[model samples]
Target: MRLNSLVKPLLITGFMLAGTAQAAPDAREVLEASPVDDIVAQYPEMMSRGIQDGLKQSGQVPPMVADSIGFLVSNSFRAADIEQRVVANLEAALTPEQLEEVHGWYQTPVAGKIAEAEIAASAPAAWPEIRSRAEDLNKRYQGTAREKLFDRFDAASRATESAVDTTIAVQLGLGTAMAALSRDSVHHEKMRERLESQRPALRGMVGQQVYDGYLFTYRDISNQEMNLYLDFLESEAGRSFTRVVTNSVQQAVIEPVESIGARLAAFGNFGGE
Candidate 1:
């Protein structure tokens, strides 16, 4: 399946409904407004203001609201959709206790904190690796095939990031709810052990196999766009753009989201009810 085909309807719906007074903001809007605000508020140095049309920062005028909304919608929708598929895959491969253990990893304060810290520590290292890998792969392939591969990787990465972040949020937000369901240290520990025992199977749910599929599909249609981006990155113009996008996304986007997630988790209380 082409990424465009998968994303077009979502983009259209988001664009048509942007800023309309619907009964409840669609998931994308709620995501855009709340999380973006939370992010800005968390980092006063990076972001002097919140989402105004787009994400405003101290030095930079934000991107157009439509563009930011589209990016958020495409990334968010893809992530949520793919994660549901992952959950379905895990449901078939793992037991209930195992699944709850996976959930527990997200629910526990230490685990959640560790995961966030790891991602932050790893991102600087990871991006260069991703770029290098993509470049090498492109060199081995030619023409449309190469383009498709890059696009697929980019889309999958975005989706994966969104999915992971949302999972963290859900886990943290509903820690209280989950505690109400599970009681006693023995029970919780047992569930954790079951999940740990099934680690291979659970990892498969978010592993390279599924991610490769997402990348392959994206590359099929967006090869040209991917090539253009790569070329720019290889040039001065692209270098600047890359720095801005990377920095803004990390400082303005990821940091705030993780902070809010931590706060929500703290508010929920780590213990299961």
Candidate 2:
């Protein structure tokens, strides 16, 4: 009996140690294990869509000109470039333990399911359906636990913030292009100030879009699953993971956009052939 008792305690201790012995994942490994690659792959297209919408709102850009601008924006915001930035930023922002925690979370079954929905939502193909059903989805989920949960989840994931940042970046790109064509000064700082001034308004507008997207993407996921997902997102590691990834993506796209004036000038010379 004594031997069995001693063995039981030893086994418990060993298991505890094993649990604490999880290896810290490298940035690349963490990213590879998550839905980041697929998501990043869709970013160029997403940015292009945003740029096109912005162009349309201007009510002055010709359809062909807008298409050309969209093409440039899409090509410039490459997935590989964004991945590189993500890796670099994650390495800087996440501690080893945080990295391991994030990697572990991404390996969960719930994470995989959520990733699937997110990946589908981010694709250009899903945009039409999401838009068409936006009103219906909003009405269906209004005043529900799921709706409240999604609002919290969106805050945790910085969805609205990232969308706003992307919008600002697109605006910056457009401004640079126009400056190059008009031989006007590229007042980047002033442009950023103007964009920053509009952030509050942008946030309000984008928050609704983000919420609608959440309703559409997570329609298949049960409340329990969403709660589980939200629990993780609200966790320290998940918050860090989301913040780093979103900032990295924004920086990557913005960097390329900054240098796009020259390329855009060349494209314009060709009449956006």
RMSD of each: 23.7, 6.0
lDDT of 1 by residue, 100-158 (tens): 33343334454334334333323323334544455454455546465445454444234
63-167 per-residue lDDT for model 2 (tens digits)? 777777788878887788789889999999989898988898889998899999989998988989999999999999889998889768878988887888887
Candidate 2, 7: how far from true, in Å? 25
Clashes of each: 7, 0
The local distance difference test score of model 2 is: 0.84
Evaluate model 1: give its TM-score.
0.26
Q: Rate the local accuracy (lDDT) of all candidates.
A: 0.38, 0.84
**Which candidate achieves the best TM-score against the true structure?**
2
TM-score, per-candidate, Cα-based: 0.26, 0.82
Worst 10 residues of 2 by lDDT: 264-273
